[model samples]
Target: MPTFTALTTLPGQAAAEAFVEALERLEPEPTGVGIFEIEDGSGFWEVGGYFAEAPDAAALDLLAAAFGARTFVVSEVPETDWVAHVKRELAPVTAGRFFVYGSHDAGRVPEGAVALLIEAAMAFGTGHHGTTKGCLQALDRLVAAGVEARIAADIGCGTAVLAMAAARIWGHPVLASDIDPVAVEVAQANAAANGLADKVICLEAAGFDHPRLREAAPFDLIFANILKGPLVELAPDMAATCATGGHVILSGLLNDQAEAVLTAYDAAGFGLCNRVEIGEWTTLTLLKPHG
Candidate 1:
């Protein structure tokens, strides 16, 4: 079976959502439609749809014009078991004291390593990406430096691996949140699979918007492995939510974007304590000034 995907980007969330609604009523009927905000601080939203057959270009064009969006990029996707492909391509990864593996590699966990089970899934952040790996290693280094945190939060936690890692190392409940509900569900499942369900609580939220997050303010440690734009936007909230002398681990940035993110945090009263580069991604460890 041939699968086709049509995607377009527009400036506002309302336009993107309207595009998705229009796509839902298309003649051939799409299999799925999604509207997502672009997280690069572009203030743009993406609308996409999947079809079992090639979508009508004329209809797509009309929809794009109506929504004031760019022309749809339509492409045929080869039929493949993406989950299986990910399992084969993503070998178990070891970063510092953490061992991230799918269930297929359960027996490969090294002795004395904190094991995190994050199966290949639709959600991102499996520790295979440099951003996730760098964050994990940063956590390890923090532990090595004898920094112990009793309260921790993982904002934008994709698979909740960082939250699970903190739970495993510190034996405390770590708040994990993501804007996507699917990712939050995946994080919850991953935490349960790793036997940290009791210690790693997952929620659907954007940054620190939830009531639970507000009540759990002043975290001793915080992890925000998101893009530079959001990282910069989050600086003030991070500063307010982090305890005095607390630590924060951040990633999901290109090498060139690190300084801007660091500067943003610096303005929010955080000093860089350490930086780890993995491939093109840079993870930063920062400390809030002690009162």
Candidate 2:
């Protein structure tokens, strides 16, 4: 089988929309898959990610000939070659039970766990990034202590992996939220794939203010693996909604940026618990004040 590549340029907004559209329309097909996206600052975007069957060599030739000079790049690929390329290029990142694939030589995720079996895709959360793996490690450490958390929330739960993990590990109902509808869809799909749909409630909301958020009121444990600036800004709201005596895991911070984040949480009534570093990322777990 030959892989097919379709490349075209569209604006930023258009490119993003095209990517999402392509993703949603994709069905279970035996196609070699890989998505490569480049944004042309000139209000345009170039995109391509697909593998085609071999018998279509003539079709590929026609496609290439049809788009001769306008502005398109098309490539034909053999199926096996594409698969081998993706798997080999996608080094597995494991932190706890999460597995992520990204740059082969990168310390994408934290150490000390098994990689998940899910095939790598453009989707988020495979413990391959410092922020995501940091969160995974944080959850692993928490679970290792045999803690049973109930009523949890995952803010900006990209792939909903954290929420799914919580539900699987602690038998808790985890509420995962993200403002992006696409992210919500990805999270929901991932949750279902992992058999966690029953316990993980995926929602689209405007930050912590989503109506579904109320359903998870005063969560006993909250996971916020978003960036540092947003984490600081969300401190007050998280503090208010996170119950006293509960736990909060915060990541998406560089080791150097950990103190400022901790300071913000401290002011919001959380006491430092543990700070773990994996790669260049750090995840800090904070316990609500006892006094």
If scored against the real structure, what TM-score would every candidate get? 0.89, 0.65
The stretch of ten residues in a row with the least summed lDDT in candidate 1 is: 117-126
lDDT of each: 0.91, 0.71
lDDT string, candidate 1, 59-116, tens digits: 9999889879999999999989889999889999899989999888899999999998
Query: CA shift at 111, candidate 1, in angstroms?
Result: 1.3
Instruction: Identify the candidate with maximal lDDT.
Output: 1
The root-mean-square deviation over C-alpha atoms between each candidate and the true structure, in angstroms, is 2.5, 8.8
Model 1 clash pairs?
none
Give the backbone clash total of model 2.
11
lDDT (Cα, tens digit) per residue for candidate 2, span 141-187: 88887766888999998888788778877777889999889988888
State the TM-score for model 1.
0.89
